[model samples]
Target chain A: MIVAEHKPLKELLALVEGFDRILMVGCKGCVSVCNAGGQKEVAILAAALRIARKRAGRPIAIEELTLDRQCEPEFIEWLEEPVKKGGCQAVVSLACSIGPQYIAEAYPTLPVLPGLNTTFMGGTVTHGVWAEYCSSCGNCGIANFGGLCPVTRCAKQLLNGPCGGSVDGFCEISPETPCVWELIYERLKNLGQLDRLEAILAPKDWSTSLSGGPRKIVREDLIL
Target chain B: MSMKTNLKGILEGSGFAVLAAAPAVCGTDLSAVSDFARLLKGKVTAVFAADNPGARVSASALAVSVKLLAEGVEPVLCMTTRDRNRLALESDLLGAGALGIANVQIVNGAHPSLGSHPSAHRVYDVDAVQWIAAATRIASEKTLISGEAVSGDPSFFIGAAANPFVKTPELHLPVLKKKVAAGARFLVTAPVFDAARLATWLDNLKKSGVTCPVIATVAVLPDAATARHLARAGRGMAIPDSVIARIEKAGDKSLDEAIAVAVENIQAVKALPGIRGVAIIAPGSETAIPRVMEAI
Candidate 1:
């Protein structure tokens, strides 16, 4: 889901104060399901912005466009023609951190402000209900423990077992959440692979999914 | 999750009922206001204030309604904020509260075309949702136009309309959500003349995750056939084939069929998991609503 923290309305109002034509860009792919950067949210934000502006007596021109996904180059191109055509003073993006970077790089002269706080990758439970559940680390280790993730849960990313915080099968940090190692233990025990936890989990490999120069993936067969 | 304290919670032990008595046209005299209030004493009963400056049934019987509620009756104040400005709204709220009446329904109100004052200019500084928000902001924040908080807090049980049976169910859902977000505690729909349409609307509300208490409105007509001859300004109201068929079989001479139709719709709606209560609207047949309430 598009995991994003909503920007305060006052801050957004301040940003578009003098801009004649403002475009509020929204992302639909992940943020839509999470109820963050979707068409509905875009409409709400647009109306609120107009109302706020009207209340302030500015009454500036404003428009909204929600693209499929802002992170990809193909999707970001859809906005290039619209922005140029509208002569937009500024483009406020409602996508994650990666999205703004792409927009800025695509059009160096246009100013792009982000409308979401860019939270962690997560999923939805129901409409208006979203919960953070994963941290993509560009690794596949789920086979060892019945598909339960530990990188996002183990506090210390301890794949081996529980530290001292597992109290009555619950994590100490949050009373509602289950302990990572406890879940691992239960899953391993159920899968007839009880001996897997016996091996000490060494410090996890840190070569992938970290703050570095720039990350890229290679698909050798696609070039042909 | 939305905060609790819905209409059901308010009326469960308080003993109350709404009496929809909207006059078919304007300029109808309401000399029997106190009599209706007296009849509904120590129980929930309401009579619509006809769209007339000559008479407002609620205002006419304000003193009596107050006296009745003082004896443990719950008086609900219903006003559509179409032409009425903030001063009028505040007076109504304060006056009702002075009379121990707390329940209030905020409506965008009907246009003047429904009345003799069609030439009257519509005064809407804000719509129904904004009006309700103003009330909530006053009560919760304890302030007024100048950002000054009142010395004492205001207590109100506010409700708004939701037409789930409307063909544009999508628009209704968003509008209802907006109203709720703006601080409407419950929903009183336009009218439910059909059972299947009511069921469909209930299902759509559930799927849409609207948790507010909705009171399905069973319209009370002089007869079933007259009710079916609906015109514009209120369109897409769902009427069941079974109800229509029943009306056709009964021909023109059946007030019993209309009452039966209203009773059946009430029962059908209440069975929906999300539905909380029923609000009966009787345009000309104001007296019949209480009977349906008693039957239910």
Candidate 2:
């Protein structure tokens, strides 16, 4: 999931303060996991704004809605009649970066802005800590580095091997983070392929990762 | 008298900078005393992050950070809301006063993910600003959230973090002021470790009229291996080439120069008015803080 952070309250307030009737739409997928554009947070943001406006005595009319997924057309259709009926001036999306654009595309005239900063596609390290493991570089070079990624894990992104900075197996960045190369070294050492670095690896081909342009994946049979 | 002026002049000349200190532990200690010296040496204030230098931050680590203050290292006491619950927070604040760590930074830390217990309930009942508001009351010797009476007050220089780079960046300023209005006495930023980034962002904060203690952060990488890990963290952190070069040249050479870079960077940031302190984030180099302070 692409984990993200919500923009500060004041930033969100400034964004929507222009409109009286606002619809805060959230997603139940990816963002829900990251707790950004998820149901609970959208409710919280809406409640916060209501409390804030009421405190100041502005009392703007704000509506909250959450869909299974906002990036899809079906989920957006759920908002049309209600949002259109309620005369929502703007739709605040609590989904990933893509979901906002999708809403804008569907309702060209309707304004859409992100409520969360789409951070990265990462997995649960602990229950809550979600460190980024992939830059979505096109190539899945896991086989080369023994499941651990030197590209994403190493502080300097050293493709070759560990620098001298590894002390007792932890990266100098902090005591918490382990040396990525150390993980690689340990993995390779376990695999009995310690000489893999001796073969002289090539520089990372970043185009495959999601950095170059719009990225896509396909499985022909499953695609249809 | 002139000596004090000269020292103040020297301190003021250094500019805006902050020293990052987490609770010092056996592994992840936020060793405040050592960090206080770094702030003093760099002529920067310290925003002590509540971390256990020995390992993961436990209740015991906070106790250690508090005790260290007695060694004449009365620096700022900093923490994320997630680092401790309100109960623990209240306890630590009381302890900090006992140790004499007057300054404090409050933040809503990221909830533990990977290494954390998944089923643990998030106790963010209070956010950073509210926590500050609550803690500041303790400084006044008022009643606490638990309705407990204190012998004295919780005297503190409260602080918070402001993200300078955002859409409508100017808007964040008022929020910062709100935190200040609520209880915060200072503003410690997740400072742009990059000098260029720092200059532009500092300029923006200036335009916003947020004239609090805008203590800029000076993160110490001092090693290539650590720089790589920080790069992976991919937070807004910017690692300069000079830093990487310093690390590369560090080799078997005595880490004295590496440690010097840490202090020197703090010294450099002290020239900025907004940069009131340095957060000595030596990361794994918790013990190295004293050495860095020696040069400062």
- Give the alpha-carbon lDDT of every model: 0.63, 0.63
Best by DockQ: 2
Model 2, B75-181: lDDT tens digits are 45556654455678888778766655666677654334312353444444455656767777776656566668876644666777765433233323444555666
- DockQ, every prediction: 0.01, 0.02
What digit string (tens of lDDT, one per residue) describes model 1 on residues A53-131? 8888777677899998998899999997789888898888888877778999998999888887888877776877666
Which parts of model 1 are misplaced by more than 4 Å?
A: A1-224, B1-8, B11-31, B42-72, B229-236, B240-252
RMSD of each candidate? Answer: 19.7, 22.6
Q: For residues B160-274, could you state the per-residue lDDT of candidate 1 as single tens digits? A: 7676654445424655666777778778776776667777877887787777777767875565565564422233345555666676678764666878878877777767766
